[model samples]
Target: MTITQRKPLRPDDIIINEPGDQYSCDSCGCDLTHSVRIKCADPLCEPGDGVDICPPCFCAGREFRHHKRGHAYRVIEINSYPIFSEDWGADEELLLLKGIATQGFGNWKKIAEHIGTRSKEEVEKHYNEVYIDSQTWPIPKLDLQFSVDPAEFQARKRRRIQALNDTPPPPLKHGPVSLPGIHEIQGFFPGRLEFEHEIDNEAEDLVKDLEFGVCLEWDGDQIIEDEEDLDVRARAKWEEERRNPPPPAEKGRIPGKGPMINGINGYHPPSENGSVATRESLPPKSDDALANGTSSGDGDEEVEEVTQPPPIETKESLAFKLSLLEMYSQRVDKRLEGKEVMFDRGLLDYKKMQASDKKRSREDRDIVHRLRPFAKLQTAADYEVFAADVLYEALLRQRIQELQQYRRLGLATAADIDKYKSDLQKRTLTKANHRDYPTDKHPYRRQSSGPDPRRASLVSFGGDSEGRKSNEREATPRLPGSSTGQGPIVRKLPTPLNLANSPSLHLLSAAEQVLCAQLRILPKPYLVVKETLVREYARRGGKLRRREARELVKIDVNKTSRVWDFLVQQGFLNIASDVSSNHASSSQDASTASGSQVNGSPIKDPRPLSSQQNGPAPVPSTSSS
Candidate 1:
C-alpha cells in the first residue's frame, strides 16, 4: 500500500505506520503492537496532551519532544515492549539526533546549541552510550592469516606475485594529493559510491594516452634487415657515371667558343645569350638525377690557377721596427735607471756605515770611561791564571816530545836540543809576559797604598810624573857601589810642585807637618762632593770652577749655605772672597811655624792613605804589558 505524502519525510517519516495499521503513533502513524508507546498521563487528550508515539519517535524524540520541549512528559505502563531507558527522555535524544543531522557528529557545541538544555558533554555521552557502546551491529571481523602453511606456500606465493604484477601502478601525483577525511560524514551518505566511480572513470579516460611505454636498447653500428641491399648492376651503373662525367654545359662553356679553346684556356666572359643559355643548360628533371645530384650544379665560372710571386724584400714593417726600437730604448733606460738606483743605494750604505762607526766610537769611549777603575784592577796575572791549564798542557807535551827524541837517538840530536832550548826560552818569555808590572805580583796578593786608584788616575798628575822620573833613573846603569845604590834610594814624595813653596817640609816634625798638610788637602765636604767634584775638577785642570762647584754642591739652594763653602774655607777654590782673609790664617801660622813655610795653595798630601783601610791594590800594569 502506498501512503500519500504531502511533504518530504524526515527521520520521523521512517518511524510512522502503514495506512491500515491501528493503535498507531500519532506523530509517525506507526502501530504500537511491537513498538513501545509513549502515552501522555495528563487527562487532556482533546487538549493535545494525549497524542501517542511509536518506539522510534520515542527513542529519537522527534515531533513528540519537539512539541513538548517546554512541558514535562511522564511515562505510563503499557503492554511490555522493547524500550529505551527513560533516564534520557525524548527531548534529550531528539536533540542529539537533530544535532547530528545539522552539524555532523563531532561538532557538539553547535549540536548542544540545537540541544538547548543538554550540555555538549551530556549529548556526547548519551550518543556514545546509545549508538556506540550499546550498538547491536557487530564490527566486521578481519580474518587475517599472518602465517601461511608450507604446503600451500608455493600457490600462495605465486598468487601474491601475480597479483602484484597485474596490479596497475598508482596514478602519478601531479601536485599535492588531497586525502579523504578519515572521519568524513560523506562516507555514510547515500550515492557517494556512484559519484566516486564517475570521477574515477573520467580521470582514467583523460590519462589513458599519457602512459609511459616500455624501454628498449639500440646500437647505431649494426645494420638492420629492413635496409636495402645493392645489386652488382646498380654498383656498375654508379661506377660508369663517376668515370665519365658529363661535358660542360653551354653556359659553363664559353659561348661562341670551340671545345679546344675552352679546354686549353680556363674561363671567358659569357656571350650575349648567357642568361638563356644558363637556364637551358641546367640538368633535366629526372627521378634518378634528382636523387643523385639535385644539390650539385656549376653556377660559377672556372677559376684558373696562377703562380704567385715571392714577397718583395723590403725594410721591416713600420710597426715592427718601432716596437724593436722602443724595446731597446726601454732596455737602455732601465739599465741607466738601475745604475742610478744602485749608486744611490751604495752612497746611502756608505753614509750609514760612517755614521754607525762614529756612533760606535763614541759609545766605546763612554764605556771605557765608566769601567776604567774596574779594568785597571785586572792585571796580566789574572789573564795568566785564566789560561794556566792550556799553558801547562802545552809545556807538558813539549817536554814529552823532547824526551821521546832523546830516547830514540840514545843522545839528544841538534834539532831536538835546539827545539828544547827554544821551548825553555819561550816559556821564560811567556812567564815574563804573564807577570804584573811595577811589582810582579797578583793584584789580590799585593798590599795597597794611596788614594783610590780611580781618584789617583784622575787627579794625581804629580804621582805619575814622579813614577816616570824614577823609572827613567832606575833604567840608567850604575856601578855596583855608587852612593845612590849603597842604600835604599831616597825618593822624595811627589807633591804638587806647581803649588809648593819649598821642598823643606821635612824640616818640621812629621806630626806637625801632617797636621798642616791635612788642613790643606782634604776639605770638609770632600767625601760627599768627591764624585761630582772629581768629574768637574777633571773638567777644570784640577781646579774647581766656583759656578760649576755651586751647582755641583747645590743640594739646597735656600741655604747660601754649605754650597762650595768647604772649597772656599780651604782657600783651594778661588771664589768671590777676600784673598788676604783666605791667606791670613796661613800667614799667622807660618810666622809661628817651626821651619818650612806652607804655601796656601799647596797640592794634596803626598803620603798615601793607609792601605789597610780598603782592599788590596792592583799591581800597576798597562793592558799591553
Candidate 2:
C-alpha cells in the first residue's frame, strides 16, 4: 500500500485478546492464569450479550483456537512423491518439515527425530517445503538429510527420543555408608546421605508431565552448551561432592543440620530437636567408657573464648557496639557453617574478598545500590537479598561484557566466556564452586541494538542534502580539468555509494538489518521515502503503524515479523501476475504492474525494483530472517 493509503484493515487489525474466553480450568471455567495475559478473544472481534465479548470469544476469535499449522512446513515437502493420495493434497512430511524449520536444517536424523518421523539412510532423502500459508511465500527445499557414519543415526520408530529428552535416572544413592573421622560427625548428624543419585521413574514421570528443564544428560560430555569449560569444570564439582559428603543417615532422611523438618536443632523445628530415640537408643549406655571422656555425639559445638575489654560501664559506647556486631558475625559463622546465609554475612564476605584482592568493592556495592531502587521487598534485610541477586547478576554481566570486549578486540580465547563466567561464579557462589552459576542470555544485550524512529527522521532530513552533496562528490571528483585523465585519480570506494553518504544508517542491529533486508533495500538509496513512510506511519498511529513497518531498508522478504510482511505485496516488487491479460485487465495490470503507480514513475509506488523476485538467496529457509 502507498504511504497515504496504508490503512490497517480494521481499527485493530490483530486483536491481542480473544472474544469470550476461558483460558484455563475449563471444567469450572476458571481462567487459566498466566504470567502474561493471552489473547483470549481477538481484540478486533467483539462478542457480547449480543455485544459484550467475553474472553473465550475474543481468545477463540480466529487465531488462538485454530488448528495450528506447524511452522516447519516451509522446508519439509515431498521431495518427489508420486501424486497418489486419498483426499489429501501432497505436501512435505512432518519430519522433513520439522527438521528444516529448526537450526541444523540439513541433518536427516535430527530432522526425523524432530518431526517424530523416519530419518536419513545411506541415501540422502531430500524434501521440498510446502507452506499451507497462502500468504507466506514458499520456502525452498532446505537440505535436511545428511548421510550417517560417525554421524547421528537417522531417527526410526525405535528412537523417538531426542538428545535433550528421556534421560535415565541416576541410581538411588540414599543409604548409609561408614566413613573414617566422619563417623563422629555422623553420630550427631544421624541421617541419610545425599549422594548424587537418580530416582526410579523420574524420567518416565517427566515423559508424562514434562515442564521446562525436565531432563539432564551426559552427551559424551555434560550438556553445558551455554559456554566452554563446562566439561572440565563439571568434574571439579563431583570431586568436591565426593570428598566432602554429609554422613549418611537412614532412608527417607537428611542429616546433621538444616531447617526444622530435618535437623533436631534447626530454626524451623520439631521443637528444634531431631528424632526422639524410638524407645530403644536414647537411654545412657550401660558401658563405663560411654560415661567417660567421650563427648555426647550431638555434633561439634564451638566454645567461644571470652576476653574482657577495658572497663566500660552503664552506656556501652560505639566501640562496644562494633565489638558486638563483630561477635555476632563470628557466632553466626560458628553456628551456620556451610550453607545459605543472610545477605549481611554474604556482603561482608564479598567486601572482605574485594579488600583482600585489592579491588574496589564499591563497584559491586554500587551495582547492589542500583538494584535497591527496584526491590520488591519492604524491609532493609530483604532488600539486601534482592540486592545480592542483582549484584551477582551485574557482576556476571560485567564479566561477560569484558569477555565480549576481548572477543571484539581479537584478544579473546575460546576460554574467555567460560573463564570469565567461572570468575563471576566464584564471586557469586563464594566457596561453593560445585554447582552451576546461572547463565542467562539477555534479549537486548547491547545498548546500540535498539532503534530510534526519530533517528530515522533525522536520517530522512540528513540524507537528501547529503545525497545531493554525495552526487556532487561523485560527479566532480579530484580532476584538474574536466577531460584530463590525470590531475588526481578518482578512487573507487570499497563500500557502496549510499553507505558512504549515511554510515549511521547501517549502524543497526543485525535483526534490524534483517528487517531492513526484508524491505529488500540493501545499501539503501531511498532514505527519504522510507523515512517518510516511517513518519507517516507514526503520525497515523504512533506505535501500531510504525511497528507495522519499522526498519525498511534491510527487510528480508523471507522473514516473518510485525514489521514487514511478504503476504501483502510490497510496493516495490513485480510478481508474475496471476490475472490474465485482457483490455480491462491490462489497464489495471499496468497500474498494478507499476505497483500502485503509473508508468514506473516516482509518482508513488516503488515498483519494478531491480531484483524483487528470486532474492539473493536460495538460503537455508529460516523461519526468522
| Per-model TM-score on C-alpha atoms | 0.13, 0.14
The candidate scoring highest on lDDT is: 1
Q: Write the per-residue lDDT of candidate 2 for residues 486-532, one digit (tens) a residue.
A: 22222221231233344456655555454344334443443443455
Put down candidate 1 lDDT per residue, 516-592, tens digits, no spaces: 34333333233445457556755765444344455666553211122244444444444323323343444445342
TM-score leader: 2
Among residues 3 or more apart in sequence or in different chains, the pairs in candidate 1 whose N, CA or C atoms overlap within 3 Å are: 16-28, 17-29, 17-30
Q: Candidate 1, 620: how far from true, in Å?
A: 22
Off by over 4 Å in 2: 1-362, 365-574, 578-595, 598-625
